[model samples]
Target: MAMTKKIPDTIKGANTFCPGCGHGVVVRLIAEALEELGHADDAICAVAVGCSCLVNVALGIDKIGCPHGRASACAAGIKRVRPGNLVFSYQGDGDSLSIGLAETVYSAQRNEKFTQIIVNNGVFGMTGGQASPCTLIGQKTTTTVDGRSVNMSGVPLDIMKMFGQIESVAYLARGSVHDAQNILNTKRYIKKAFEAQMAGAGFSCVEILSPCPTNWHMEPVDSMERIAGVVSAYYPIGEIVTGGGLNA
Candidate 1:
């Protein structure tokens, strides 16, 4: 018999993300985690504006589009209203770390029982590759043609390090999708965040170091190399917090 398709039901069809972009990989990981955890039908995503918005179409599951940088706030509301549903927010560095910083911080402070996945490509990828809050100090972008200067722009925000300090954060981790091992690890971290949310543990998040080939003006392979090389140096991969919230 021809092998039955094993594609996760959460994945409806082909994605429109740029070739070599890591958003596709991260979306796949989310689907895999939801399917494995038996939350495919119960999952609800609050997608942010930008490239992250496309995830709503790529994943067949129910989702709501939030205002720029408001995905976390929206997801938290959904989770609060429908506590049984598995709720998560998909956002980028520009949305999560920059504009949505207040929402993200207070959500953790309130111990909102939900998961958030932040894709940190270091730039405002969908908006002409502007330097984001997480953009490296010397990384070049449309707004930082001379490479980011500390004097002009403050240091890149280490979101995980900052969020991990919250007393109500149940889980916080950073991972990359640049290699096979790292991809697998990223999936694990994502799954753990979802599990934490399902357990009624407080807020949880996973910041994924993703690649933006088109925005970065690099080939796909070189973009992956940059994630493994330049990106990982500042945003180290690994779990930061395990348990320190309501359930913990």
Candidate 2:
């Protein structure tokens, strides 16, 4: 009989993210997936500024820090220079949807051969909880003290739909880590995104609806509930693309 192998010792340390922070969970999932797929050694992760900036410490993977919002461009450059390596980027909502919007859109437009993980925590957790591009309508943040108003702050950007419109994007999906089921689904999406990259299909982006307990001024458990009830309601979870299952 064959024996089930254990996860690598490299991923045993305490994560840097705060309690109820979804980044740590997602990072572990990605790391497990990489190990399972035997790409752990060849994977190169690029982390952007914001909450996800210190991804290197969380995941025992080869990681590089990119500029404030240039994770996608940096990932593209790495992939272009080292086509054999599995390249990915870990970015937060502020990093990817705000300052990094141009790079994200252009990379998808060009079908860059890489995978991007966008953690949409709604608020900027690392920088005083400012309202982010993915912040839900009527949600309150440091910048939106009285709830986000459409008149003041345009509608939240539906990044999945926006990138789905780009012909070059091969795989796009939105998932959440607010619940056990959604967490499983998020892992599935991450695996698919990695597979898409390995198959050289095109760009793949997985948007993860995460929680920021500290920013929300709520306890960890309450923050998770908020993500499930409010966050998921606004940003429904599911896959937007599959690259025609070419990667499978």
Q: Where does candidate 2 have its weakest 10-residue lDDT segment?
A: 239-248
Best by TM-score: 1
What is the C-alpha local distance difference test score of candidate 2? 0.87
Q: What is the lDDT of residue 209 in candidate 2?
A: 89
TM-score of the candidate numbered 1?
0.97
TM-score of each: 0.97, 0.94
How far off is residue 105 in model 1, in Å? 1.2
Taking the tens digit of each residue's C-alpha lDDT, what string does model 1 give over 1-248?
A: 79876889788799999999999999999999999999999999999999999997799999998999899999999999999999999999999889999988888888889998999999998888999999899889999999999999999999887787788899999999999999999999999999999999889999999999998999999999998887898889999988657767
Which residue runs of candidate 1 sit more than 4 Å off their true CA positions?
1-5
What are the clashing pairs of model 1? none
Using lDDT as the measure, the top candidate is: 1
Candidate 2 lDDT tens digits, 31-143: 88898778989999889998897677777878999998899999999999998898999999999889999999999988898999999988888898999988888888989
